[model samples]
Target: MKIRYKRMHLRWIFVFGLFWLILGVISITNDSENYFNYGYLIASLFYFGNYFFKSKNQYLTFEDDIITLNNLIPKKLNLVDLKQIKRSGKDYILRTENKELHIKTKFIDKNSLKDLKAILKNLQTN
Candidate 1:
């Protein structure tokens, strides 16, 4: 099973990046010498580039009892080796004897969150 990041969460990145890009373009066209507009333009590019490069890989994949975190630094955890599952604020921390993995719930879609909770519940019980 693969759990995806919420669409709304990804949508916000585009919204904010476009908003800043528009503001920067408008300000530039107005012949203003404000350095802040340049900053905004640069920041928007960073946001857009980040979204384009990383968004597609932002998900959790579970296969054959191994969980793969497909983020900046990909990680895999064997479910059978997980020693503890605990909630820390909005994140779920899964611990093994010498390793820990954090699941950021805020970026997960609602239905996926429910499914993830069910999966974790089963893990906790076993």
Candidate 2:
């Protein structure tokens, strides 16, 4: 029916942005003559702005032979066209018969993968 996906982790971005911001502040305080200090501050601001505004939520759903993927960016795919499903390390690949579609699973747990496989199997049999 409906499956909800998770949001991207912002902790790393926050940490990196904070580190850069601190570095820039320290540089500005220590060397008032260098323009590079202002450059770092500008760069840090850009990173923070991008991190907060542009990130999207990721999710996958299978319903009535169609699989809908919403990774903030939206995609609609028909499960009937799906040719193969495979697991490669942490990612799951969904290949279509036309080779035009390649769906990758994100933030899916072991139970979710099992559930998806079961759904696919039913689709194949019918």
Best by TM-score: 1
Off by over 4 Å in 1: 32-37
- The reply for model 2, stretches above 4 Å from the true place, is 1-8, 53-80, 97-126
- Candidate 2, residue 111: CA error in Å? 9.7
Number of backbone-clashing residue pairs for each candidate, in the order shown = 0, 0
Query: Model 1 reaches what TM-score against the true structure?
Result: 0.77
* Tens-digit per-residue lDDT, 10-65, candidate 1: 88888889988998899888867777778779989987876774577767989999
lDDT of 2 at 115: 78
lDDT string for model 2 (38-96, tens) is 98788789778746643443256666887776544557777777777766765656678
TM-score of each: 0.77, 0.52
